[model samples]
Target: MAIDRQTVNRVAFLARLKIDDDKIEATEEEFNKILNWVEQLNEVNTDEVEPLSAVNDLPLICREDNVTEGSQADKILANAPMAEYGYFVVPKVVE
Candidate 1:
């Protein structure tokens, strides 16, 4: 559909945008150009084209989700001022 001055005014009001009176003509022309481009795109045949989540067909690089207890307890506790039973020793917050 072609964009008109009234359509531009209505759209601006609905979108809570302020288009200067002088720029309204330029804005309407830009909108018309975009619509014409979209109309041209609609004429292209894509009946056999498959819809894709991504343009490329590269496989997702993923690591195996292995469930296990962490093995870095010693390395992590080495930086702590004190550690006990494979846990960091922090001051008790509750009385």
Candidate 2:
């Protein structure tokens, strides 16, 4: 696809870019090159190819989920600077 100065200017305005008048031609050329590369990709045949999420086909391993009460409150509270009645004490913020 051919990219013109007007198209480049419109894209620049939408993207909020400040392209100088001297660089408009260069920007248009770059846009045309990218569009040409994309057009080339359309010529490739992929009818027989299968879509894949990853290269490897290995199945993901998972573990069973279990529920249990945690019993390490004393050990966890040991690091607290100020703890009372098995809880952390901080400065009151509400009036």
Per-model lDDT:
0.92, 0.91
Clashing residue pairs for model 2: none
Mark the regions of model 2 whose C-alpha exceeds 4 Å error after superposition. Answer: 46-95
Clashing pairs in 1: none
lDDT (Cα, tens digit) per residue for candidate 2, span 1-95 = 79999999999999999999999999999999999989987798979888778888899997678756588899989999999999988888698
Pick out the ten consecutive residues of candidate 1 with the lowest summed lDDT. Answer: 63-72
Error of 1 at 69 (Å): 29
